[model samples]
Target: MNRQQKGWQQLFLFSLLPLFLAIFGASGWLWWNWAISPAQLNAAKPQQIQIPPGTATQQIGTKLEQAGLIRSKIAWDLLARYISSQKSNGGFQAGTYELSANQPLNEIAQTIWDGKVIQVSFTIPEGWSLRQMADYFQKEKGWFSSQDFIDAASQIDRKKYPWLPADIPFLEGFLFPETYQVTKERITPQAVVQLMLERFEKTALPVYQKSQNQELNQPKFTLKQWVTLASIVEKEAVVQKERPRIAGVFVSRLLKGMKLESDPTVEYAFGIRQTPDKPLTFAQVRKPSPYNTYATPGLPPTPIAAPALESLKAVLNPESTEYLFFVARYDGTHVFSRTLPEHEAAVVKIRRERQR
Candidate 1:
């Protein structure tokens, strides 16, 4: 071992140390950025990325990378494999996801792995019928078939939902109207119906049950009858403040054993909607359907449409009034009258005004 040879060996080792240090620094930086850093630090908006059914993990990683939601596909693959190894049921769920570029690679991977897909929302307006809701779902494009929804609503599972009236013909007014949020996995007709019914049980049914014993100075109605009357009010009353007034008139008529003569009932009987241009014709009102209040003295067989909470409440607590008849003014209000002659005069005046 000469001094010269030892010096040469030391120099060689020192040169190798710099090369090793450089490699180590580069690897650490890549790993840190790939695993923990976001693609965009200040990204404000999220991008919608859809992972179709049966999409492979690698494919999903590629999608996230292309959508600029993650920094690297390789990092995603490694993290996904590690996550899959930890869980017994290990796979990414298929659906649309709202992912932001500001999210770290691991957080985004966990979201997809946990099946936290984006929720889609749909709204059913007040007084909408089952057919209308079915049509809406069909028009929404990817939710469900209209016939499927109709079939689901028609087939009532009493065992599952014992609160429903046994003899109620169909679930016309029971499906509570509201905005519902659902994941792609729950887009089936049965799921949607179940949600609405459950919402009714939670929101609407409780209202009826709470008022079951209270005497509102009105006619005592069964659950079916209450819903039926509420549906009528929902359709007839365009003005929010007129709900109780309109309900009171109907209550007065019902108590006196007189026909309700509700125009909505006539429309419901014939399954036709009347417009200002074409009101209910005499012949249509004369049609002998059990639903026609014009021909029938009592309430209809079933609810004509779904009633809102306000309308249902209006029925439960109707305003005490002497008015027995009312007519729409084509505006969002009505003219109430105590006698048929007064109602006729109001109708004549409204007609003349329309003509002018």
Candidate 2:
């Protein structure tokens, strides 16, 4: 080759070097922005986003981008494909996710790929009734309606839960009260009720079963009767230490064939909750309802509320006391009395204290 041709070739190569460098720099920048850097480094909170079932990787990327969680959909598509190629069953899981814009693209992709869906938590306090649970779920975002929970709880499948009492009209105290966690996909009323029932079978039912042979000397109360008494104790005893004492009072009343006269029973009958400022009225107590303990003998047809583990335990082993009467002090403590006159005097004293 001639010297001039060789020199021209070298110049041509030299000129193209700038273009190669520019291309390399641009590629590096794109990789950093799309795959490495966060969309918003200062993002404060995470946003809950739902990934519908069977959503494609490309569609998921688009959603992430739209939700301001990812810098680029194209980058997500490439990353997801790479992950799928590397792993046998690598795919984004479907369900609700809590994603933050501050998270890196790879981290977010891995979260979805690993099926780490956001777990929603709901808590049912001890002594809460089925209606209260329904109302609570209604208040929670994205949960089923109050009526849905009530209806689902009402339909008890004996085959699935053989531990449930056959004569139960509806799942009242049987739906164990505790904090439960479930994914967004399993947030239906039926699912929640099943979880509660299962928890009851696992926790509360075992306690009752274990105590069956142990409480030989105690009153032979049926499972439903025990739960009914426990629920009453749960509602009556606000102070934790007083649970056994309250339960003893109810057991004594039941033994003597006397009316329970529990204020909570009257509230349950009328579907009302009374506070210290507003006590149960004479008319309300006299209101003719099967659940009105003041007017009815023995336990109501069903439990008025869900009993806690302690309350259930209290019923199993009540304190050996002769006290059959009690009045709430409005300060979570109760004044126990052996006679009706003492109870009336305690009630009068409580009323005077509240007035002062």
Candidate 3:
């Protein structure tokens, strides 16, 4: 070859070497960014991102990049484009999604394409009253209104539901406590109440029937009475093991024709607003109301709160015992007693512990 041609060839080779190196480095960077997570290695919680409807892929990439969920918008955008080209309807759906920082870019893209919107769950804790439940819905962000829930609950005919008693005055005891899935723009106050009632029937009816068989030799009570006693036990028992024992005490009291004198019943009479979490005053306990077990005989007209399945089962099949009294100790537990003197002694011990 001529000298001029050789010189030109060497120049070309040097230029192409730099170009090849640049291409190789860029490819390596892209591969690493796509496979490794951008989230901090020590991040304990996944960040939640809301992808609104009609959001384009470019916007999604930008959002993910800004949220530290993706290492590169360019890489994510390219992957999303590739996905779109490959599959029909390969786009992110509008809903809440939980994204961990350290997830692979390909995994995230696949998740988005899957359109699996995160299902949010809300739990109605055991022993929560209707008013408390209503307040919770109202207070929670994007939840149904409290007044709307209360109105819906009131209007629901408990008897119409096959699971509940036909003669019960209201639906207080039938809104079973449970974790409910809340979907976007789907659940309403009325819908939630209905769901809870349905769940209650599905869960409690079989237990009630079983109780009927077990207590055939004992005094038979209606479903309403069983629910009422369960509600009382729900509020009274903090320890899971003590629920049946507490129910037994209440049952024994009812059989002997003695006053229940339950503090939760008194609180229910005062309504949720006036009820105090601290110990009730003498005046509050003595106040006259239909719900006040201290003033009225037999079970209260209706349940004071939503009882858990455990509480319902406890009432239906209470431990057979002669115990008739209980007092709260300084701790979360309670001391049960068979006699007035024993109960009085427990009360004194609790008071002494409080003083100390």
Candidate 4:
């Protein structure tokens, strides 16, 4: 044990210490990287998913993880935070946005926030019948229809829709018209009707209930009656703002024991319940059917179609007018008259306008 040898031995030991530390540190780093890596980049590589509006951050993170976009949820949050911290108003907009695996957390956040969504806007006009709606849906390659729209729309168990009458032939006025998102694999005629019914229930039912609450001794009409009337108004009225007035006119006529004489009722049976393009003639009005308002004195067996909130509101609260008979004035407006003479005059005026 010479002093020089002892010094050399100590130096060797000290040199070995750094090597051991390096090996241990490297192993630990490798383990961490292997065990705690972020989302599987490969998993998300195959598809670009649209993140839906109102998706929870955790759900989005899980989706990313499942989709193999990122290695970890923490990374997503970190990225979101980094983006949020930037001098920007907000991080993202709510929509169906596309994403895929291997996409950086920063890009994901920006895309989601930027709301580069793949959404198809489905527009259902306010006055379109369920048959028309169904036909429109059938034509869209985006959606699949299992049955004819008219048949689908007409198929209803009055027991299920007790809001409907027992003798009703077709349920027409129950379908609400408005723009809808129509989610993928989630769209169906039944679903469409259910959504419309739910929306209608939200807005129309309250009014019907209020009306029910007011009367005693008078045979209470179920919500179905109101829906039927609303459907009539929706089809009969040329304009939205005129829906309630149209409903009021029907109500007035009904109270007076008069036939609805509604063209839609004629259309529903003889003219065009399923077909949008059909001419209505006096012969069709004279044809006998439960849906023919010209033939049947009371409400048809069921709602003719789904009605919007405006029509529903009109049914629940009608305008105070002496008029009952109404005809299209050929100017997208209607001519209303109380008596037969007035109605005849209005009809002549409409005919003249049509000829012009």
Task: Give the top-scoring candidate (TM-score).
Answer: 2
* Native-to-model Cα distance after best TM-score fit, residue 170 in candidate 4, in Å: 7.0
Per-residue lDDT over 1-356 for candidate 4, one digit per residue giving the tens place of the 0 to 100 score: 99999999999999899899999999865443331224443353335665666777767777767666666677666556667788458646655555655454566666777666655557777766666677678786436563655565566755565565565555566555677665443466666666665565566666777877785433355666777777778777767777767877888888889998888878777546523233476787899998898998988877776677777767666887888877775556777777899989887776666566
Model 1 lDDT tens row, 1-356: 99999999999999899899999999876674584435466654887888999999999988877777766788888888888999998678898888787676667888888878988899999989888999999987557789999999998889988988988877999999999998876789999999999999999999999897776667788999999999999999988999999999999999999998988888777789988888889999989999999998989999999999999999999999999999999788999999989999999999999988
Q: Give the per-residue lDDT of model 2 (tens digit) for 1-356.
A: 89999999999999999999999999876684574335365654788999999998899988988887777788888888888999986578898899887777778988998989988798999999999999889986548799999999999899998877889989999999999889988989999999999999999998899898683667877899989989999999999999989888888898899999999999999988888778889999988889999999999989999999999999998888989999888778989999989989998999999999
C-alpha displacement of 246 in model 3, angstroms? Answer: 0.8
Instruction: In angstroms, give how far residue 22 of model 2 lies from its true place.
Output: 16
What TM-score number comes out for model 4?
0.64
| Candidate 3 runs further than 4 Å off | 1-118, 157-160, 213-215, 272-278
TM-score of structure candidate 1: 0.79
- Predictions ranked by TM-score, top down? 2, 1, 3, 4
Q: By descending lDDT, how would the candidates be arranged?
A: 2, 1, 3, 4
TM-scores for candidates 1 onward, in order: 0.79, 0.80, 0.66, 0.64
Look at candidate 2 and tell me the lDDT of residue 165.
82
Instruction: Give per-residue lDDT, candidate 3, residue 148.
Output: 86
Candidate 3 has an lDDT of 0.81
Candidate 2 yields a Cα-based lDDT of 0.88
